[model samples]
Target: MGDDLPPDLARLRVLETWAAHYLTRIRARIAAVERQQAQQQTPAPTAAPPSRPGTGPGRARTPDWGLAEAGIGVPTTEIHRGDCWARGKTLVPVSAERARAELADGTQPCAVCRPDRVLNRLGSS
Candidate 1:
């Protein structure tokens, strides 16, 4: 009885050695796969300049002439009369008094807002 270690213990030792070897191989395989994946998936950085100050993600990349026109406070009729003004042809917002004055001066109400000329005045067709 003193010399008898169970057959299961002998088998357990063999399994432990095999499991250790298997785990080592698996770890090596995982490391190799990770390295290969990293090499394959890595993206090269671009050479474009960084965004300017005050700019944010999702900001329009193209020029926005509407904001530019609004910045100068140009009259809508002068900017958009012939479609020559492009995107900035929409009218800048005005106060109620200014709108009344414009209406009194024979300026036609915008088609979109026949009754409420003040709202959505800047949106172009």
Candidate 2:
């Protein structure tokens, strides 16, 4: 009223300042979303499916073979077939002969994919 702001007017000014700040933040967020929409990207290319006769999440497919590692300095624990979704950390690709040998040596075939059954049915190599 006379170089001194009234209490109600001061409160209104504080609220207006807060609203302006919030509006600015909301505008910035909206702009970011708009920019993202304007620059939409194509999805990454997918790899071709496995070339096996069978089809499923688990089957003879890409990778073909691999060894499931137990841990650092520990012996490899399990052998898994290609496309076995439940395989743990794969240490290396295993050959058919190696998979057969390992399974015979008690390296424990992956229970989920039943690599032993696949190997047994496939028969040597």
**Which one is best on lDDT?**
2
Best by TM-score: 2
Task: List runs of model 1 lying over 4 Å from the truth.
Answer: 1-7, 44-125
List, residue by residue over 1-125, the lDDT tens digit for candidate 2.
Answer: 54454458887677666765565466567767866975796546669854454456675345787788775322348888866655543446789889989989889887668988888888844
Scored by CA lDDT, what does every candidate get?
Answer: 0.43, 0.70
TM-score of 1: 0.30
Against the hidden reference, what TM-scores do the models get? 0.30, 0.45
Off by over 4 Å in 2: 1-61, 72-76
- Per-structure clash totals for the candidates: 0, 0
Candidate 2, which ten residues in sequence have the lowest lDDT sum? 82-91
